[model samples]
Target chain A: MISPDHFQALFDPRGIVVAGASTHPGKFGFVALHNILSCGYRGEVFATNRERAEVLGRPTVADLTEIPHGKADLVFVCTPATSNPEVLRQAASVGIKAAFIASAGYGESGEAGLELQLQLVEIANELNMVIVGPNGQGLVSTPSSLCAQIVAPYPPAGSIGIASQSGNFVSSFMNLSRQSGVGISRAISVGNAAQVGILDMLEYFADDPKTSVGLVYAEGISDGREFANRLEKVCQRMPVVILKGGASGLGARAAASHTGSLATDDRVFEGLCRQVGATRASSVAEAFDIAAAFSTLPAPRGPRLAVVTTVGGWGVLAADAISSTSLELVHLPADLRDTLDGLLPPRWSRNNPIDLAGGETKDTVPAVLDAVVGHEEIDATLVLGMGIQSNQGRLEREGPFYPDHGLERIVAFHDRQDSRYADVALAASIAADKPVLIASELAIGDPNNAAVAAVRATGHYCFASAERAVIAMHRLYERTVWLESFGEPNNERH
Target chain B: MSRTLSESDSKDLLAKYGIPFLPEVLISQADHVEDALVGMTGPYAVKLCGPNISHKSERGLVRLDINGVDAVRQACHELFDEARPEDGATGVLVAPMATGLREFIAGVSVDPVFGPTIVFGVGGVLAEAIADVTVRLAPLRRYDAMDMLGSLRSRSLLETFRGEPAVDLEALADLLCSLSDAAVGIDGLESIDVNPVMIVNGLPVALDALVEFSDVEVEP
Candidate 1:
């Protein structure tokens, strides 16, 4: 168990000290100090440097005791590995409870580095100080408006906790958050994991009120028992999306002749995922996609899903993806199909996808969407008609490209139609407590695209393609189906 | 430093706890083979044993489908005397040959940190290619066993397959529970691999089992 005193201080530090503060730009020390200041941390900042009296417009002290703010709550150590022992010793003497070390060449380098890292952990334990990394990147807590990492794209605040072994993913996830509507609550790159591992941070996130979904990228677990035990507890509350790595080479090794050899460590990890209620994804892209779906939608009641599409081809593609997952699409219900037949034209075919046919009127798409999403038999709905060109009435009037009297006029007319269509889907989704996922060829995977961003802003989701949308729908339902067995949840807070 | 219980002793140990092992008898000499098969019905399986011989099939030390009593005697004599010196055995085991519609593998694998872990899955060559399996930490409850079966990729094997009824879940659960109890109750047990727990009609009977002990010696 982690100490509550250190956990609270490291997360929401009231005072921060930059031990290796530098005036020169682009160095880790300078960027570490710069990020803390730029993110508007409410805590007091103390910069300590030996070469100069001040750095980066803040007065620097040669020693930690010179700070007038008394003992800082947390310290960000950005010095070399050879000098970190002395630096941390001085900080611990000043009653600092937590530290985020953003230096490298400690544990990951080799034998010499490993011994130094062990010594650092020993000092940390003796002083009761929680250290993030001795060879790690930094971390960020949106609740306190703190960004102590040098990674780019400090995303805007939202609910989703990320704990990763590779520090690069921390920055990459931040970039993904910028593209997708889902934002992060906390991000930690647990390098080396001398004391605090992925399971510990996951437990903290499970208890944290600010985070509703967890995204973790792990290479290997040193303690399988602690991992499974902690995972069981964490899964009882919030859902965890895991992306396990390092299996391509290990699977190629020579195998034993025993029948039990069939179950490798990675395969057992998949079993562990089933035993513990966590969703496993094949790639980081899928992990983020799963997190985005969970962050926006409620746990589906079951794996029964429906796909409502304007294009006949998309519905078939989506149906295959649904069946591939743990989900199934029964034939359109009798009563619901009857209602949909009324909304669709006479030319519409009869099927579960309920394709709106090529000659669909504007009313044909929205009417089927509402009826399907509201049906009790359906657990979740995926609507795939958010196209940019000709999706909003190519027949009623000449499209923008027909005659762009002016660029502004063409875009103005397109925006008005886009919002009108978005409102229909959003209102139908909000009308029902069930989740509604949107798909489009044009409005996908880009938050900067106002057409897609506006839909997401309304608490609705838009995926890049029909296949992706269908996959997300299937994952969301499975997470819900898994959580269903853990008894009733508090509510869909996200 | 370590010890290995013979097949007969391991079956005796499991039989005490109500695990469904095939009825078998141990013979110290070839002359005792016929007397041991008095109550048992044909066909019979004859397996030669030695202290160092763990995998009998790979070394061609096992004879199956011996229908008549004379055939059983000839097979047993050849396995013990006609084979190489390494294949010569101090004892032989004879059991009733059992037929089944489905095959399963269940056992205990000792993990360094978590101790014994219970594993259940499909058996035979398909076990590796298909990789349909599930694992639970020892001390499994009724639901854990049931969930273990349901978690397999070929979970349909639990349902009606090829005109055969599903294996009795209650009996399978009881077998797994007993297996778990034995694993947890025993000390210095390295691992146990019970393969081809063949299911006939709806009842399961364990046909073969291999138990290995850890090298670390305990005071007890």
Candidate 2:
């Protein structure tokens, strides 16, 4: 294991230098340097180019040794693979502790590239510096507001930390974060993993104070036992959601070509996840949703769940989703049913879902949510179709009768009420020490919906569908169960 | 590079590690059948045992449900006669016929990446077709063994089945742990296949076992 200071240098460097800074708009050298300076990275920035010139309005040095001593702690290597060894040696001489090599043509490119990758590892080891990727995308550390990657869209700063074996998936996750407004603390793509691997980044996340949950995308594991051991240690501190890529024969072959990875048997990998108590997601979307839930919600005490829905179909969908998981859809006890009956219409379903049946008054949704989330038998509550009011309000505001009928005031009131419902659900969940997952298609269909905005304002993700909400709750419940297996309390992390 | 142990030798090696096997006796000649059955019960299965004869039943060298001593003697003589010259037939193994309502397969195979892994699941002739199993890395903890049993998709079979008691999970867990121990302790061990681990009134007993060794010499 590397020292904490080394990881800190990788993630929270004081100053940074781009090895191959360029003025051309097409080159990664330009983009990497542009993203760092543009994303509000408050540090000393330097560039090394073949010729001494100004790039991105910053004077470029012809070599790394030109940088003053103790000025730059990290280097973003954009030079080709053949020159990386000399670049690393120069960076080491100048007191740089970490390097993110954005250059390709390394281990994934075959024999000669593999040899070059070995040289890079030897230099990293000799210098005792963290080398992120020899053929990978860049990384992001929101604490420093550093989006040093060559990609666009730096996500909002939040708790979920991501490490992926593939660069495109990192970009995809960041894109989801940008669209959904669920921020990230740190994200790195360990391409080819010449010097630093996924486990190293994950362990760093485990010790990182800003990160509450970890999302990992792995195509292969070089050492199964070591991977399991390190992963188990990380899970003890925070929940981890994993998405494995190469689980099938065809996928394994593809992975072998993609990153020179050897895929283990998918079943064994599945069993290993279960044994280590890491939540395994079947898709990238599912992995992010699960990680979002872990980042925001408290672990549930048990599997019992209460579904509160505005419509019957969402409730039915939530119920159907619950049937496939270990989560139990609790039967509404008589007392809770009576409480909901008092708060809802006579036609409302009195069962577990407690469907409002379109009969909710202004206060009905919030009052019913409080009653369900506060119930003793319910470990968590899933509120479905929450943004319907705001969704409807947007539609009516677009019509011709908007201001003529005093519709402006009515839409404003509807939006406020929708936002209030989100606040009340979140508040009630905190008061009851349970998880309340709010889901609506409007989260994805209409990102500007009031309820969606409200949930995002509090730094919690509003799930796109009932099934996605159910999957999140199920993962939370699994984490709780795993904690109990170690005789640890669920709320200890909180 | 690897050689399979004979049925009698496999059972002997596994019995040393606390894997329960039915009481049986080995006889080199048919004349010793009556004496070998002195303490054991009748209604036995007699099979030709040899280092090279790994699939005795497939080769029609196995006879079951012999009641009388003369019947057992006749079955042993027929089994020995049925053995071909290349079979390298060394002896005959006779064990009392045991009945059970449920069968399970438990074994240890070295995974290329994960090393020795324990596999447990539904057993019998359709075991391969059913393909219902779960694995855990070797040197399993007690809880890991329990998790393996619980993880099996056919886990319901371990419950009380057809008026018999539920499988003794503690003993079964112990068996799995012992297998894991052997996986780590034994030298040059390639694999161990214990199929049809019959559940009799809830207790598990290994009815058939095949232990393979690689790059090592062992007496047949």
Candidate 3:
């Protein structure tokens, strides 16, 4: 596990040096350097390439001796496994407290590689240096604008801390989040997990002030009891979402090959996931959505929920989603029904979905929201097909308008309507201590629409699909239910 | 690679920790059959006891539903005749033929990574096919046992289905916890399979059980 002091040095480094930064873009060192410089990191970064005088625009030093070594906090070892021990020795001499090793050919390559991995860990331990990965992609800390990873461009910066085992999955999750406008706080790919595992990352995330959520994509865990104990502790402070791969015999073998991780029966893992309070997401996208909901929205007090939708079909679809999750589309109380009777059109479906059935206009969204979230019986609300059509319709209409006329007027009008509806929905959700998930037909289609982006900027997720929104709400409820089942004590975390 | 303990011995082992097995007696000779059946009810099940015979009924070493002393003696003779050199039968044993509205399998197996784990599910002939089972790490708390029971896909079997009364889940949980305690506590114990535990009037009664000890040499 990365210690508290080391987390600060590794994630929020004031000064960083890339040990093998390359002049060539094709090399891993160059990719690592370019990501940090392009992400607008406020901290100073030095490139150490013996073959080159400079990397990108930054001046290159032959070694740590060229710079004030004691001041550099983190060193990215963009070198081979064979040279990592010497780099560790050099880094330890410089007083570097932490490092992210992007080199593979560690334990994943077999017996010999496992020996090398042990050597690397031994060196780091002796030097008191926190090592993130032996065979990892890289690490990214959004709060510090530190994109030290060698993958896709940095994801939109926010507060969801992600720790994934597969580097490819981390990049894919970031790309998906980028498209969905889901912001990330910190993400690390714990390759081989020779030193840091899911539990260690989760513990660090717990102490992270900027991180209120921990998301992990793990293939396997080394110790079941230790993992469970740490997970239960971390969950008390911040909601943790885990998406495990390798559920099958063949898949487990694959996972073992990829990360040198021992595979437990998936069923046992499920039992442990329930025994602890972490919500298990079945897919990468679901993990992102659930983490976003748990981090942004207040957990639902109960499983009872209400769906308010402009499109009746979407409400029905959301109802199906609610059924699949541990949520109920319960009947509204008489008092809430009376309020809705006064607000919604007479033709609106007098059911739990509260379908507008084509009777709603953009102006009526506020009152419709007031009645839906206003119910004491409802624990959470899913507002589907709300004012999403405006973004897509406006974009298409103004696509070739006035042969290059100013499009700000149409965009502003759309933002005004979307923001107005969003405010009403969020205010009620906040006041009632319940979450309001918004999904629209067209705007939700983009998922990262300007309106959705504006709403997500507030930290809450507004999904394009009503089903995902409902599923996220259900996951939040499940997390609360699991915690409640444990009767979490005040001092649950150590 | 482990040896199976005899039925009576296995029952004794489980009874030490509060697993309720049916009343039975081990008789090395047919003359002791009538005496052994003294406390048992009218219907009885006679089986050939062995150190290595794991499946008595499948090996034709078992005779069930014997009502009279003559029938009991005939069953004893038949079981002895059926026993082969490999059957490993050393004596005849008689147990009360337990009847119940439901059957369940409660046992423990050693998982290579997690160590001992408790298994609970529907039992009898359909156990393998129904395969509606749930597992929890052994040395389970009462709460863990209850959760395991509730998590079974065939959980409805424990409820009052049709006109049959619901199986006493609290009692089942106790049985599971006891087995888990043994699975975790005993160093020599490798696995225990108590199949078709008869649920007589909602109370679980072990009708048949097999306890296997680890064959691996323990480090001195």
Candidate 4:
């Protein structure tokens, strides 16, 4: 029954204390201390370590008792798992509102760990205090510019908020967010989730004004009906992306004891996702990429796509990618077909991939992009950067630019650098609103480097292959459609 | 939307829906059975009925193929005399025997995911063992009733299994459809179970049925 306003205490705190903080590098406590400082939090920040009087040049207390204020709005218990009980008991005596247990090796270890976790939960309940996790990475706030962990950088301050169970996976995801340029509003690691579980966080984020797109990295979920209902309500207004690990049996058990989560038959979750319009990603990378695209891109009008390339073979390969996804290689409209036919030599594939055959100039790239992207039927556009490089190189071999102008002057001033083509593609991306994928054949494994990076620098997609790009683009389209179509609580329309 | 009526309420509910039921009296105590027997026809069945009691046949609440006042009087006393009153007791039910029946089972339930549903199958032990049942979304159409009847693996029961005459399946389908229709129409209905829906010769009749109500506010 609690709404967004009630959840403010968890995300926005007036004061924060990083217990067990240190100046030492590579330690979890030190990393957490550094992250809190880096997030630009204006609130009161305190650090405590047994040995040091100062940590990262900030004044450190000998223990919780040394803080002059005598109390904190939130306490981050970053000590060993075994020491958490005593630390929590001491903190509770002073009426600490919330404490995040960033210690690992709790219920996830075995029966002994589970008993310890249960004891911690009982302690928190008795003291009327809230514990975030017994084995959690802690929480981050991009809107408030507050991060509680040292393992990763804050996501680029966007509307999407993520809650994950696996700290390592979530940390990696946060790192990936930096690489991909996808920002987040909040990313919380609810490890073990002994006191505050996914349901509580989900309800918090569902009504959270800062979050327009939601991502959950879950091992499993309990209370299927309640989760389904709550998510269905949230999905109507925001896209809720889900990545569930442990498709196998052993993983299912680990998932359960880690968070007291229910892992039902896999198909049940699949069916539920389909019914509720939640985007389900198979892997961590896919989850971030899909979440990235969904949060950043506009809704595509249709599934029809146009692949514009400078090479015929690259065009054929790009077309092949559409076979796996829902996207269709629509027939080029007659006017645009005629336009490409007139611009290219008769040898060019009149159909698509308008192979410039190395004869097309830098200016021609933008022109062709404009023609393809402006076509009414095209849902998205993919430009092959490798095709531009090889084809334009071939054209250079067959002709001289000018006899009047010197070769150095012509090459330096007029011809433009090899990477300029990426800029033109990026411009088309901005105009199209559809995902513009720049494919690099030379860098087969990591196409987003150099040439593809050239395009992505302009804020477009840089994929390894046309097929992968098409799949990503199609899934993004489906996610947008789903976000638009979901029902609002009891007022289900369809 | 499927509404369930208690045994006494079920009889009244079904009769109003045009389900032909045997004329009977619902006596609260064993002493009232002697008075109730005068109105009942000979060769009548005697049974105990209450809200808390379901599947009374297994509980020895039912006695069938009986004749004469002494047999009816004895069966009634046996049912009511041994009854435990503390078990959310409603009352005791006494009804005449429905003879010449080819038994079948009918019920209505509201599935959490799919909403109101109706169930049909063969009656008695075979129904439990084989579970030859069919389910249709409730407030069913005429075609849906036919579809449900045809769906069961023992659908041949509707068309003269052994020497039994082809139960008037069209008539039975109509009855099922009407019950589902009534269930949807009722305000407080939750679940309905009409077991041993006796098909006597060609005509169908209800031998026993039960209904459970929703938690709607009731006037005291």
Best by DockQ: 1
Clashes of each: 0, 0, 1, 11
lDDT by candidate, in order shown: 0.75, 0.84, 0.77, 0.67
Per residue, candidate 3 scores C-alpha lDDT tens digits across B79-168 of 778777875657888887887768888777665555666777787777667767777676676767887787778788888866778989
RMSD of 4: 12.8
Listed for every candidate in order, the interface RMSD values in angstroms are 4.3, 9.6, 9.6, 13.5
| Residue-level lDDT tens digits of model 2 in A301-326 | 89999998888998998999998888
Rank all candidate structures by their lDDT, best first, as comma-separated numbers: 2, 3, 1, 4
Candidate 3: where is the Cα deviation over 4 Å?
A: A247-264, A361-364, A391-419, A439-444, A448-451, A464-467, A489-494, B60-72, B86-93, B98-102, B215-220
Index of the highest-lDDT prediction: 2
CAPRI quality of model 4? incorrect
How does the DockQ of candidate 1 come out?
A: 0.31
Could you tell me the fnat of model 4?
0.00
Candidate 4's TM-score reads 0.60
Q: Write the per-residue lDDT of candidate 3 for residues A70-144, one digit (tens) a residue.
A: 678899989888988988888878778888999889899999999999998888888888998878888888889
Positional deviation of A206 in candidate 4, in angstroms?
4.7
- Which whole-number lDDT from 0 to 100 does residue A107 have in model 4? 90
**Ranked candidates (TM-score, high to low):** 2, 1, 3, 4
Q: Please give the distance, in angstroms, between residue B99's alpha carbon in candidate 2 and its true position after superposition.
A: 3.5
